[model samples]
Structures are given as structure tokens and as C-alpha cells.
Target chain A: MTTITVATRPTEAPAGHRLRFMFADMITVTWRNLLALTRIPEALFFTTLQPIMFVLLFRYVFGGAIPIPGGIPYVDYMMPGIFVQAVMFGAVGTSVGLAEDLQKGLIERFRALPMARSAVLAGRTTADAVRNVFVVLIMTGVAFAVGFRINTTVVDYVLGAALLVAFAYSMSWGFAAIGLAAPNSETAQVMAFPILIPLTFASTAFVPIQALPGWLQVFARHQPVSVVINGARSLMVGGYYHSTSSLWYALLWIAALLIVLVPLGVWRYRKTS
Target chain B: MGANSSIAVDAHDLVKVFPRGHVRALDGVSLEVEAGTILGLLGPNGAGKTTAVRILSTIIGPDSGHATILGHDVVKEADTVRRIIGLAGQNAAVDDYLTGRENIRMVGRLSHMSWKSVGARADELLETFGLTDAGNRVLKTYSGGMRRRLDLAAALVAQPPILFLDEPTTGLDPQSRQDLWRVIEGLVAEGTTVLLTTQYLEEADRLARDIVVIDHGRVIAQGTPAQLKADLGTSVVSVTLADAGTAQRAAVLLAPLSAQPPLVEGATVDLTVDDGPKVAVEVLRSLDSAALSLAGLALREPSLDDVFLTLTGHKAEVANDGGTPA
Candidate 1:
């Protein structure tokens, strides 16, 4: 009964055809984001540039004042801490950009498209992870330039880098979820502060956990930020890798964050009524 | 793709209540659209046009209605329904950062076209929408009309059987509106069924083959333009003048010719008169006696606006673009 005058139009489909359509659509969304970012290479520059500057600044400016246990240099100790923050904060940029998209009604347009429900977020998180890798590499190079040498063998360094990148990649999902759930950009910033500040300051990101107050020390030791920094730092310091407990802790955080944020983000998307 | 289905879109008593019973956005509204013709949905603000469009497009669910787009259920089979329907909103749903070509290509990709096919379709749409020259330029630099055209082009990327236009020309200039109307005509000529919603009377008159007139979330009347106009009781004789009291005196003279009482509104005088042309001349003779400046006179059949005024005792609010949606 379809009186379609055109001879080359599709009229009916099966279930698998639609599922593949969603997958293909997500790949396009990912490419669209990357293409949009190509013009503003500044995000790439800032992500890398800001982290490099911080590592150098903290090393030359305050390295002499702060003493470390076992006399490990501040440059060597502070590099991993700054690296994690730089990458995590890099994710907040994606969150803010997501907030901007919401205001502009871009997200609504995507929802109207019968694409993969999670593809948009997945594409963003994937691209962000790549950005974090480049940013972390810059931070790592600068750390080495400032007399912060990795005492561990080459294999350990690779393992540590892999862990850090994985951690950063996983973190973007939470931030992406926040960007979608946040009512407005200002609220997004407000919400980010409480989550980032407590996680960053309470953990052994900048200093060792034993250096904090009694109540904070307990929290500092168990927090995900502490586990991540210790894990990355342990790989660089060959002597600390004997236990490898920090690596497991970091992985636990990654798994835990993915389980909580990904579904919540997807659920929020479904309710986009 | 239900290109083979005779019924492009069929719905029954679709009702959608937003924010519980306190707000009834769409109250028991339903209509069907045959394949290949443009079915224009005309109503003033809050007429449930957008709500019905949303329900049919599968963007939101109807509380008590069932709809099938090309044989796919709007709710239960949303993915299938979406595959056959394309929607372009009053506000341009485009990403400004991307180029027109890139935006359309992205939509093609989302619709599952291969990258090569996506790029090819993007170019085709860009040329058809008169945006080929601006294809490479970012949408941020495009004019308002170009952005809207590109938005429409993006919606058509999937080649959906049914197109949903929700006030497609709300803010466009006269020239741009005409351009969109042409594009819509082209769509229908190529066998695409359209469910267009608009608040502009002229747009509905120009585009809709069959008009569905809605008010306060219900269809007041549904018919062809001529049929709807004929249902307005009697022809209206409208007169425009340059000087004072011409319309007043004309109303007095035209009173006896009217099936209903004559009405004098501002500078123009209108009367729902029988055999309006015969009565229009009589009105002019009275105005000539007043020695008032004679500007112009128009005697014509009643329009949808007049029908709206006659039925509701007032025109529907023009700007019913509330924050709520169907």
C-alpha cells in the first residue's frame, strides 16, 4: 500500500538493523565532537600546557621548602599528584562544555536522533581520555625535565602510565554524567567544587596522608585520590612496588565509579522528557 | 521504513497530560495523515499542534492514545517510528560550531549511513537547501534563514517517510518563509507525507492540503481550507478608508445586508453579509455620501482567522510558545 513514488527508499526494518544504526550514530557523534574541537586546539594546548606549568612551578618554587620522608625530592613526589588533578580537572572542561550544549539545545537535537543512547557520552569520554593522555604526557615530560627521575624499571613505568590513563578515562564518565544532570552551568561549577575539593585536598595528592590531622588522615588514607596517587607514585619509585596494594585500590575506584555514573547518566538521558 | 504502508500516520484519541492533571497539554486529540500529501496543522498558540506532533514523533508518550507511523507504534515501537519520521522545530536544532555540511553528515551517520554515503547525502542536502556555498562555513556565521534551512536539511537526511514540522517558519522573514514553503512542496512532490504545525494563518493556507484547526488542546474543525472557510456562516465585506466615520456609516448601510450584525473595528468595517459583492457596492455608496476618504475595499469569503474569531468570540493568543511541551 506504500504508494512511494521513489523507487529507492527503505520502507521496513528489523531489530538488528536499528541497533547497528545506534552504534554507527555514536561513532559519528564522537567524530563531530572531535571535528568541532579541531578548530580550538586551545583545549588541547591548555590541557597539556597547564599541567606542565604546574609541575614545574611546584618543583622549582616550593620543592626546597617541603621535605619528604626517606628524603625523596619534592619534584619526584609531587609530579604524580599534580598529574592526576590536571587530568581530572581537564574532565571538568568537558562537563562545562556539556552544560553549554544543554543551554544551546544541542543535546535535545541529539536526543531527537534515534542514535545510540550512550554513544554521545561514550564518544565524549573516549575523546577526553585521549586528551588526558596527551596532557599527562606533557606533565610527565616536564617532571623529568625538573630532576624528577623515575627510579623504577621501564616495565613499571608503562604499567603506571596505563593505570593513570585508565583512571582519567573512567573519571570523565562521572563528569559527563554531572554535565548532563547539572541544572545549569553555575550549578555544575558548584557541584564540581565539593566533589573535587574534598577528593583532592583530603587525599595524599599534594602531601603524604600522615601529614594531615587525625580525622583527615583516616579519610586521606582510604580515599580514591590517595589510592590513585600512591599507585602511580609506587610505580615510579621502584622500592614501593613491593606490595602493589595501591594499584588494586585505584582499579576498585575505577570500577565503582563506572558502575555508579554510567547508568545514572543513561537514566537521566532516558528521562529527558 | 513503511513506504509500502498506505497509512503514513494513524493515531487514535491521543491524550497527553504534563505534570499530572493540573496541566492538560493535549486533551483527547487524534488525526490521521495519508501518505504523500502535506497535511497542515493550523492553530493559534496552545492549540496542541506541537503536542500532537511530539506524540507522533515519539519524543514523548501519550497517556491514552495509540499511534502508528507507517505501521510502527509511536510508543511501543519508537525506534521504528523515528526511523520513518523527521521533525524540524521552530527553533533551529543545529549545532553552531559545526559547518552545515558537517552537521548534516553527522545526522546521516546517526541514521546509519556509511561514511561515504553520509558525505554524499550531506552534499545533496546542502545543494537542495541553497546552502552549498555556505557548506564549509561554520553555522555560527550563517544567517537565520540559512540555519533554519540547514536544520530542515538535517532532518531530511534519513529520508523519513513522514516529516513533522512544528511551526517551521515561526521567526523567519517573509522571503525565508516562502523558501521553506517551496522546500516543503518539493518534499510532498517526492512522496513525503508532512504533518506541519503552525500558528500563521497564511502559512496554513499556502501549504496545508487538509487543515486541522485546534484550540485549547482540541480540534475545533478539520477540513480543506475552502471547507473551513465556508463553514464560517457568511462572507465578510471588509472596507478600509482614509478619512473619519467612513467605516461607521458603511456599517450602518451594510447592516441590513448582513446575515448577522455588521461590525466596525478600528479603521476597517466588516460585515458578515450575504451576497457580499452586491452588499459591498451598497456600502461604498454610503461611504461616498459621507464624503470621507476612500482607501480600499475587499469583499471575500471568511478565512480561518474569522472562523477562529467567530467560534471563540476572540482570536487565539498568537504567542502560545510556553515553556511546557506536548
Candidate 2:
């Protein structure tokens, strides 16, 4: 039998406490996610190692199979493209994690606590964005080791990094959306593949859209990946030819994603059914 | 309304309708827990117990109800309500990849405590739960009991005065469960007012000073365990299947225990009698004399099962775990 032992001390009566997510909450959530990632080395392998290997493989093996319109080595052409695709595909991991948490009812626990509703998603996205930075850096280093030199000035390099930063930020929203919406980890993975695989193959990552059939060329040119990659290539060429079209399209994609994702994430945040 | 402004938990017309308004998860439910009192909301699964817990805990907004914890409305002042209450849901809420100590520290940090305080509190809770030895172990490595205990400790990281625990000991082994029960009793002793929702009649019978029974979104009865059992009559004798023969043999052999015919469940037999334990012995002896193979037997007084069957028509069972009916 459970006995209710009454402690003699007067209870610490509650004041009119308004809930606030302290700075510590954000730090803790992010740190916890990082620690969790550390424990599961496999997540590290897929998010970091696989992308690094792909950048090398696609640059060497697949690069020779295709040619760039600018007459550069296909490695140079595809490296930027790989960067964008990896960020997009890596989102699947975030969604899968979200799905697992949902299945286990951890998200509901968070809602019940005093933490800010946005903090959970924000902390996760921020942690993941930090992770993406490492993935990009590793991939960049591998490209450099493979003799893919950038003829761009320091200013152009900074601009490219800035663009990558914004791209990663926007891409994280898309991934966060998938994570919050997909019902389970397996479903999330399945959903992510359709978005990532098609986005990769359809973009002008490996070759100039000119080589693609006239019908497929339209899609290749219009894809946000193609625009971002081209923008990056132009940036790499010492800012010689700047096309606002690619950057604008990338922004448009981000805006579109936020329009759909913010509400979805919020709905997922509050839903108990 | 109670004159005491310090009445910790106050809910009025706390109604919640789910599944597109088809089911009433909480129908005009109302409750008030004086500060520092451990009030147990007792009911079976699908009794709208968890639904009520979620609403009052601020996890879900009620459709047409008002709830307050420490003077904060659950809907209008949800953020404030959240600050005053800690909720441990039915499942283990710990992140399996993190160590138990890390999980506690993480929750403490989320409560906005200083790093030193959070760290100190983490160690304190770990010690309190007798988990100091296993604190560094990853949650997945811990047993079901350990995970559940960790969940309770996590909810306390914020140090909220009003705590809500929904079936906190559902799958724990007896010893681990006792350890958690001890922790909860200690919390209430230290002035924490808990709102516990549980199906374990023994739990409510022991820990709850006041028991509120809900079924189909409505509060059917509310009182102390003695009062409830006194009202419901006596406990029921239930026998589970030894192998896979179903509850037919038990039903046939224990027929005298029931006013009506013994219920032949898939793998168990259920019967209500004036003295369950005494009758169970007679039933077993009679069965053995008849050479009938016996499975497992349990002697329980008119439990929440009897209370449930008296109030509704059926007993609460595992098959109805997540099925919140209208």
C-alpha cells in the first residue's frame, strides 16, 4: 500500500508564474540534441560522412561522365550542386528524428512543460543548422583536397558562404516541415527521398541544362537547386557574371516553404490527436 | 468557488470534445485541489482520464472549459499555467539516447535555472530516485522501471508546485514502482500538490486521499478509496490463463463467485463476490478437487474494476489502452 506521508514544512506556494523559456532551455535543448547525435554515430555517418563521400564520388566518377557548358571540369560544376542537395537530403534525418519523438510522445511532453512552443523547433533547427555547417565544411575540404580550385576573390568567397548560409537556413525550414508533418520515421524517410532524389537528378548539378532533352531542360533550368548552383558557380568565377534569377528563385523557394511549413510546424506543435 | 485563494488546481466546466466533436473527452468536469494535497483522478483506460490530465496540464486546450493552476487559466493564460504545473504522461518521456543524468540536467536547464543550480538539482533528483548509480547510463539501457522513474524526475526539474502524472507506474516492476511512489509521497510531503490519474486501483486506494472516477467524459463518482469500495461492494476474483486455453476453465470452475455466470474472457475469468480473496481460495480448492488445470489467480477487493463495471457495464482492460470512446 502506498502511504501518503505529509511533510511538516510549509509548502512553497506558487506565485503568479508566467511561463517563459529561459535562455538555458534553448541551450539545453540544442546541447541535448548534439549529445544525442554524438551517441548515435550512425546519424553522424549519414549526415556528415556520406555527404563527404558523395561530393568526392560525384566529382570524380560522375563528373567525368558529364560535361559542363562553361568547359570547366564537371567536378567544379557539380560541387556546388552537391552542397545544396546534401543540405536538402540531410533534412530527412531531422524529420526522422521528429517522427520518432512524435511516436514516443516526447513532443507532447514538451508542450505540457513551461517551455516556449517555438523553442523546441527552433532549438532543433538551430542545432541542425550548426550540423549542416560542418557538413558543408567537410564537403568543401574534400573538394579542395581533390584539386577543385576556386579562382574567385576573397569577397566572392565570402558572398558564396553568405549565400550558402541563407540557403541552409531556408532548407532547414523545409526539412523541419517534413519532420513535423510526417507521421513516423519510416514515413518521413520515404517522403524525404521523393523530394531529395528528384531535386538532385532534375537540377543542373552534373551537367549544363543544354545537354538535357529540350523537355527536361526547362525543369533543370527552373529548379531552385540549379539556380543556387549556378549562382554559386558565378560567385566562384570572381563575380564575373551575376544572375539575380537563381538567387531570387532560391528566395522564392524559401518563402514558399515558410508559408507552408510555419503553420504545419505550429499545428504539429500543439496537436494532441 | 472555494474561499481559499491558494486552492492550487481549479477547473470549472472543463469540457473537451475530440475527434471532430464526436466524442466528449471531458464533459463538464470540475475539480479543485487544495495546495499541497495529492489528489488522484482514478479511472480506467478510455475513461477520459488522460484527456482531463492533458487539458489541465496545458498540453491541449479545452473546447469549452476553463482550468487554472495557481491562478492561471489553462487556455487564456496557458503559458502561465504551464509554468506552475509539471506533467508526466503515460509513456516514458525521456530521450533514450541521453544518459539519465543528462536528461535531468537538460530539463533543469529548460526550466531556466542557472547551470550550477541545474547541475546541482540534477544530482539531487538522481540521488532522490536512487538512480545515482545508473545516472550516467543511457535511457535505452535502463529498464522500464528506471525509465518511468526518470520521467517523474524530469517533470520535477522545473520545481512546479502542481504536478500531473498520468499512469506513471503503468509498466514498472513492483519495487521500482514502490520507489517512485515513495518519491511522490515525499514530494507531497514537501508541499507539492499532485493530480494523479491512474488505473491501478491499489494505487488510488493507497496514495490518493481523494479519488475521482470519470467515465465517458463525465465524473461519475468521487471520494476516498474506502468510500468508493464501500459503495461498490467487494472486490472481484480474476484468473488469467495459464497457457492459451482462454478463461473458459476459470469461468466454469469459479462460477459460484459471481452473482451471474462467471465471465469467460479470452485468457481470464472475472467474478465479483463479497470476499474476493477468501472465495478465490475456495474456488481454487474446488477446482483442484475437480482436477481442473489452474492458471494464475489474483485476489483483489472491489477494485476500480468493480467501480467501473458498476458505473459502466465493462471492466477496464489493456485492450482498451488508447481507445477513448465517446
Candidate 3:
């Protein structure tokens, strides 16, 4: 019989110590995923490339065809909307990443480890949130280059950027649910696009509420995406539509998205193999 | 070797009915691995081997019954169980985008090791798995064998007392499989209890101390590899008859000398008998006396294939270097 070697086996850490490790482990998972982003330049290139193309298409192609109220530059009005759309697209990456992990059996390995169960979702969402922040900063630079100037103070701009990032963070939880539900990365993209496309296009992100047909205008005005867009626009441009309630509505939608999607995502993650 | 030795891995009556198509992947399966010993769960594909490993490792919950690793319950004390057990699943779980070293370090950090220790351990494992040269290369650039080795290294980052390897060499070439087998042997020598699942009988024969043959979601036989092979107790005599009409009469003529009832397939009759050559000669003479011509006749030593054929009424799905039964 082989002699037992106490030194070879890992002793269990105490409960209190393990709780601290959970956060640390979550950060490690997040860092690993971010490192993956650096390695996959193609995915990042395509992701950012699509949004930049949208900005150029709307600026040169559609800008001449449309006019905003109060003689405001369309560039000024559309920048915030572009930022909102860019962050929303960034959130879809969370689901695709998570689904890809599941398909590759990486999640099964993680689940088998003693790390915090929340770390998988936490790390994925956090990584995607950081990516959203990066995307927003880059889009902001592009907007400026194309003559999109902020009419508000520096504090308002920072807060608007922060709000956009927070909204993307909230959206990550929803997409995390989709990722856990999808069987593979391709399926995750297919599943996300339908929901995301409608939520983004039917809102005021690209066009004013008046430009849409009356039936679509109702959706464009009241949707969460529209609320976030309005909140961001008012914060950046500071106009008649800039009300404190717009930010409150965006925050409320964020709270609702988290309260519902976080638990659903965690539940689905627990149920997956 | 004694009965008082601690059970490192204990599972009782595990049942898993998958939601999709309601396939009953596992039904009432149970086994035990004594401390510092290996238990090979051997079976054909879709025989509930992966399901059992997943349930034991807490990836999926069993429909009923329970399991424990290193005295911690797999379900109730899963966190503790996770702390003590390491698992390398069917698919290599290393991140394709990360370097081999980074993948190991990632798992080490997730296991709650300090950053310094994570780096140290990653280097140690990279050396041990012969991955030092490729340590800085991303996994997508690594060979299939290297990826699997890195995955196994990831599982060992914490040096858990018990390890589960689910078909570690499933898709590997023969040379890679041998390299992995050596690494596993090294780990076992360091006093780790292992539960390995594989379709290769030769793998179980080489590595397992005790073997459990499972089929159709249940354990069909259990013993040491030698014991399982020895229980067959005789060779198989297969006789191909020239007179198809006389095959049944030939089987009746050989019944008393055969250990089991003769099995007839097409024009051939297979009999399990002691003293295979003598039995083959006697059967040939008897069939000739009965005016039944013989097309071909042979007596062969029993192999694991015969053992599988006897237990499951079919051959194992894997292609293995067939070893003659002793």
C-alpha cells in the first residue's frame, strides 16, 4: 500500500479565508478573459470596426437626408446615440464568450474547481464592461474627429460615459443569460442579434422619434435603449430634452435588468453541464 | 490492500436522466476507489462513463443517490469536495487564446494560490509535462497532444488528493497516449487516488488496479483486470461447418464437452470449453462422424474482447492491441 503523504494533498482553506479568495478568483477569471481580448485582435477589430462604420455611414450618408430640431448639428445629437449602440454591441460579446467557454468545456472545468460559482459570470461581465468602456472612449474620439462636440461640462461628459458603461454592464447580465442558454458561440450570436437589433433600431439611437412611423415612435420613445440614449444625449448636449428624470429612467431600467437577469443567468449557469 | 483502508472515492446508486430526449445516461451506478489506488471505469461509448464522472465532480447533479470524494459529499459539501479533487474532462479545457503558461497560471490563481506560487507552479508543471519549450505559445498553436497535456496540468495546479480523468487520451495518437500514461503514473506514485474512464481495455489493463465494466448505464462486472480476465476460465472454440443443415445437430453433439451452450451464428458454432485444442479436435471428429463436413475450425485463447463479448454480447467499440487472456 502507498503511504499517505499529508504534504502532497491540499488542505481546505477556512470559510472566511475562502470568501476573500472568491473575489480574488473572480478577478483572475476577469484578467484571463481580458488577456484573451488582447490575443484575439480579429474579434476586437471586427467588433469595433462595425460601430465605426455605422458612425461614418450615418454621418456622411444619412446626415444630409435628416435634420434635427433647434438647428443643432446632427453630429452632436448622434454621438451619444452611437456611444449607446457601441456599448450595447459590446455587451453581446459577454454572451458569446460565455457560450464559447461552455461549448469548449472550460465552464465544466471551472465548475469543478473550488472557486466561487459567481466568478464565471462576474469575470465575463466585468471583462465585457471594460471592453465597453474602451469602445466608448474610442467612439468618443471618432465623434470628435468628425466634428461631434460636447455642449455640456466635463463633469456631465464623464457622468454620461459612466452611465453608458453602467448600462452596458447591466446589459451584460442579460446576455450572460443568453450565453448560458445557447449551445455554442455561433448560436449565442444568432440568439442575441434578433433581440438586440430590434431594441437598438426601433429606438432613438439612429433616428429621432418623429422620423419613425407613429407605431414605431411609441416603441422608440419608451424603450430602455431610448431612455439610456436620451439620458446620455441630455447629459452631453444639455438641451430642452435634458431632464433629471431621463437619467433616473435609465438607472431604473438598469436596476430592473440586473434584478431580473442576474438571477436568471446564475440559475441557468448552475443548471448547465 | 486491507479492508480497513480508507475509501478515497465513494459513490452509491447514481442516476442521471438527461433532460434532452430524456436519455437515462446513468441508472443505479456505484463504485469505490481506495486511497492511493486507481479505479478504471471501462465501457463502450455512451455507457454512462462521462455522466458518472460529471456527477462525481459536481458538474451536474445526480437524479438520486450520492457520492463523496476524500470524505466530502459531492453534493452537500461540493466546495470541500472541489478543494480535494481535480478533474480533467473529456474535452481539453485550456483557453486557446492564452499561452500554455498563462492557462496553467490562470487555473492556479483560480485555485486560490498566491501569484508567486502560481508562477512557480506553472513553471514546474510546464517542465513536468514537457511543455516548457512551448509554454509561451498560445494554445491554438499547440498540438492536440500538447493541449491535452496543458489541460491535465491545469487540473493538477492545486495537487488535490483525488483526481478524475475523463478519457484523457481519447483522441490522441499512440505516442501521445503513452506520454500521458507516464505522467499519470508519476502522479499516482506521488499518492494520488485516481478515477479514470476510458474505452481502451489495454489502458485499464495497464493502469487500473481494479476495473469496473459498465454497459447500458449500469455496472456489468467488477474486479481487478487479472481477475476479470481469469474468470472466463477457458478458451473459445469456433467451428465453421460445411454442411449448413447439420450445424444444429453438430452443436447437440458438442454440448456435453462444452462449458456453456454453443452459440450458432450463420453456419458457425462457437463453444466455450476447457482444453480448447482437445475440444476442437473432438468436435471436428464428432461432426465428421455425423456426416457433417467441416469448412474451418479454430481454438483461441480468450481475450478482453471475448470478456466484453460475453458481458455485453458485443465487442468494445475501441480499436485496441488485443492481448491474449492468461
Scored by TM-score, the top model is 3
lDDT of 1 at A218: 85
User: Residues A74-101, candidate 2, lDDT per residue (tens digit)?
Assistant: 6666777777766766556677777787
lDDT against the true structure, per candidate, is: 0.75, 0.73, 0.85
- Superposed on the true chain A, the predicted chain A of model 3 yields a TM-score of 0.94
User: For model 2, what is the error of residue B81's alpha carbon versus the real structure, in angstroms, after optimal superposition?
Assistant: 1.1
Tell me the TM-score of each prediction against the true structure.
0.87, 0.82, 0.91
DockQ of each: 0.33, 0.31, 0.50
- Any runs in candidate 2 off by more than 4 Å, and if so which? A1-24, A237-264, A267-273, B1-6, B234-305, B318-326
- lDDT digits (tens) for residues A18-123 of candidate 1: 5566566666777877777776788678767766776766777866776667557777778778888887887776676677677776676676667776787877
| Error at B11, model 1, angstroms | 2.4
* Best of the candidates, lDDT: 3
RMSD of each: 4.5, 5.9, 3.8
Give a tens-digit lDDT track for model 1, residues B29-148.
878777888788877777688888878887778989798887778888877666677788777778888999988988777766678877877877888888889999999999888988
- Candidate with more favorable, higher TM-score: 2 or 3: 3
Q: Which whole-number lDDT from 0 to 100 does residue A99 have in model 2?
A: 79
The stretch of ten residues in a row with the least summed lDDT in candidate 3 chain A is: A1-10
User: TM-score ranking from best to worst?
Assistant: 3, 1, 2
Find the 10 residues in a row with the least total lDDT in model 2 chain B: B317-326
